[model samples]
Target: MSKPRKGILIILSFFAIYVIWGSTYLMNKIVVTEVAPFLLAAIRFLSAGTLIMVIAKILKFSLKITKAQFINCVIAGFLFLFYGNGIFVWALKYVDSGFAALIVATQPLFVIILMRILQGKKIQSKSLMGVGLGLVGMYLLISQDTLVLSEESSIGIAVIFSCVLGISFASIFVSRANLPSHFFVTTGYQMLTAGTLLLIGSLVLDETWTSPLEWSGKAQLAMILLIVFGSIVAFTAFNFLLKEVSTEKVATSAYVNPVIALLLGWYVLNETISVQSLIAGAVLLTGVYFINSKKKIVIFSRFKKN
Candidate 1:
């Protein structure tokens, strides 16, 4: 690809991950209200994956993958979509969307820590400062009277934290994993793999599955957005960026998603935005900035292909 074209793709991908993904908190929160978490996730991923596969085939992108590549895709699917997203959505039952986003904002911290541990990469001074600030922000967010007063809220927060760690690890793994060269193909397979697992989970848990025709109009619309924009567009951008840039650079989306989720939650859902929450978000985003400040949008000359 040409330099200008690559730059445009990078910017567009960032916008998808940063802005589009932020809105998904509200989408998932809305859908999960009436749908069981695993069921909801399964539907979204299955639909999106099928759509992506159809599009890829029409565009003549090869769908074939070796056994090792398929296995890696399944692993990525499990870590990222099944546990990271499905469990996170389950937490939404007990936690507010905006608050959940704020809590998950600690993802960049997790990513950097994993890099240091797994790769023995030295942490920069700025990143160390970022980690300190992120911890402070996290403490403030979780120590709120609302969270402390409710046992369910505490469990939800802990679950979301675990999801963030899994997602963080997935980000690092995707950077090195061999998969289909085309982002669409890779994303489709992973989504399908995760969707299948989530379906089985939903059945195993005996979660009631409602048909789409019976869903409310608003829920239907939210599901559509979640399937198309959230799952397809934003997730494809996420996969693309993991290969194109540094994981820390891609993790910068954490800095923006909470702010967007907060505003949308406050405006649309009328979710309370506590003053402490605002302060925490500010501190957390600043920490993210410090962690990612030195990282640039450096695209790899050749994407890793199976």
Candidate 2:
């Protein structure tokens, strides 16, 4: 590929993942207004997975993996899409989409702590500082009266934050596992597995197929957008860009995501944004930047002069 063309493609890919993934919070909120949360998520992933599988076959990509790899995919699928994503959808029942995104944006904090606890990883000074700042930010975000959750929003925020553990552990697990050579193959199978399980769960919950008269056109369109743009296009772009760009650069999506969610929620849904929440969100994103960045954070250094 030519240099300029490659640059354009890279930019396009980044935009797809960043903007589309961010906007999905609002789209998901819209859909869940009509369809059952887990069922909507199931359909979204199932459709995306089937589409990607067809495209992979048409392009003659390898669709084969070992039994162990398939099992790994199943585990990751349940952790990531089934639990993490499903819980987020359920949380939207009581919270604003933007608020949920803000809470979910603390995923790195949870990941860092989990690594320390489970793997005996040493926490660096910079990480400690970032964690401190992130905690303060989270406190500010949740505390309506500046020091405590005002009863109404506590459970909703807690529910959203709980998914962070699922996603963080899943990410760590997948990082250590020897998965398929093809990104699409792994993601497709993972999505298919998650979708299948979610569908079964929905069935067990006695969720029947939502009729056209029951679900609005807006809800239908939102699901379609989530399946195509959010799941398929954004994920393909994300995997591609991870190979193209620096990891820290790709990690910027973590910061931009909540911002996009906040903006879209305010603009499209007319969701109220508190000044305290906005300030807290800014601090939270700054902490996330510090966590991802390599720029030296010199809290203090102890050196013995010889």
Candidate 3:
């Protein structure tokens, strides 16, 4: 592919990822009302992971790895897939999809802090400002009457925060660890490991499995779309794009996803979008823009100097 064509393809892949994955949050809210949260997530990841593994095998993708690489994959699976998505699934049981999405969108802010702490690097001023803005946005998201002081709401907030922390830690660890060169193959292994953990958790914690499925046909269809498009296709595309595109460009998905999720929640779930949400979303996006833009400006300046 020509450079321009390749860039366009990467950008399109990112857009697909943002839309599909963002919609999954609302779908989870719909489905979790009927399906067991852990059970549903287990099924989604297991199916997607199995399909990816089979494809990798058929393509003759090598699993050959050093012992260290295997360890890295295992840790990443636990942190990213197991803890990240697992907590997210749990949170959906109590929180509105829009609220959950707003919290999760703070992942980039967490990632920056985790990177600084783990790497012992000095924090950038822009990044600290982004973190502060994200914190303010998060406060705005949960300060409403809907999210106040109930036990379930508190638990849901904890779950969402746990997921954010897990992703932050996982991202930093993965940055320094040795990973497979084949992105699909690596992601397959991580997904498989994470899915298995979720399955085990479901079996242990969820005692009654015989509850009649209570979802409408529409919700069922949404679940299928979540697994196929959201978990499998979108995630695969995201991993591929990460390899092809700059991280800053890929990170734009963070901003795009919240907007998509908010709109979907409003239309499908009939959730009210508060003015606070709009303002917070805009502020969060602005912070992310400044943080990423600073990097680009630095690179361009060096190029000009050279």
Candidate 4:
């Protein structure tokens, strides 16, 4: 593809990812009240994964992968989807989706720390500053809410943070793992494995699914949107962008996602956003800017050498 065409594709992919993922918070907030969170996530991913895999087969895409690649996908699926997103969906039961998204936005900081520990990568000064800023932002965001921190919300928050950490660790493995030649094949396998695990977990943990079918139709529509646009389309666009653009650019979705979630929560859900949350959002954005700036510098230096 030509440079201009590739650039446009990357931009469109990024836009789709940001918009769709941002809306997922609102969708989750709607759905959590009716559908069980883990069960809902399991169904969404399982259906989407099956659809993608079938489409790939119809298109004559190769599903034959190396044993090592299969194992890698399973491991990443366990970490990223089963643990990461699983915890996220569960947390929605206790916390506001907007608040949950703010916490997840700390993912970049976790990724940096994980990279340093696992890869022995040196932390750039700017990234260190970003971490400090992110920590302060987190404090501001959480302090205004109830300081008592009961058992349920505390556990929910801890689980969500663990999910971010798991995703960070899984990403490092993903960078090094042998992958299938076709992106769709790889994503299909990962989603299938992860969704299956989530389904099993949900069945084991959750009691009888008692949510009535007569609830608000709007909530049901939101769940459908979560499955169709948020999980399927957004993820496909994210994978496409990962292939076409620098990872740093693709990572900017973290910043865009929270802003969209915050706005949507206010507009659609009528969730209150305080001045402190606004300040924290600014700080978080600055932290992401610094983190990505360092990555861009490295990319530019490599390009100049080439």
Q: Highest lDDT: which candidate?
A: 1
Residue pairs in collision within model 3: none
Estimate the Cα RMSD of every predicted model relative to the unseen true structure: 3.5, 6.2, 4.6, 3.8
Q: For model 2, how does the per-residue alpha-carbon lDDT over 1-306 read when each residue is reduced to its tens digit?
A: 698997897889878866898899789878877788778889989999999999999999999999999999899889878988886676666776546655665666676667668665566777666656666676676565433333566787777777777777776566556667777777798889999999998888788678645788898788889988999888777655544543334445655676577779888978788998799778867766666555653211211112
Deviating ranges (above 4 Å) for candidate 1? 91-103, 135-145, 149-160, 270-282, 295-306
TM-score of every candidate: 0.86, 0.76, 0.79, 0.81
Which lDDT values do the candidates have, in the order given? 0.84, 0.73, 0.69, 0.72
User: Global CA lDDT of candidate 3, please?
Assistant: 0.69
Clashes of each: 0, 0, 0, 0
Assess candidate 2 and give its lDDT. 0.73
- Residue-by-residue lDDT tens digits, candidate 4, 11-107: 6777787788988877877777777767877877888889889989999999998899999889978887788888677676666554665677677
Per-residue accuracy of model 1 over 129-213 as CA lDDT, tens digit each: 7767876776676567453224578888888989999999999899889899898899999999999999999999899989999
Instruction: Give the per-residue Cα lDDT of candidate 3 at 101.
Output: 62
Of candidate 2, the 10-residue stretch with the lowest lDDT total is 297-306
* Best-matching candidate per TM-score: 1
Model 2 residue pairs with clashes: none
Q: Model 2, 78: alpha-carbon shift in Å?
A: 0.3
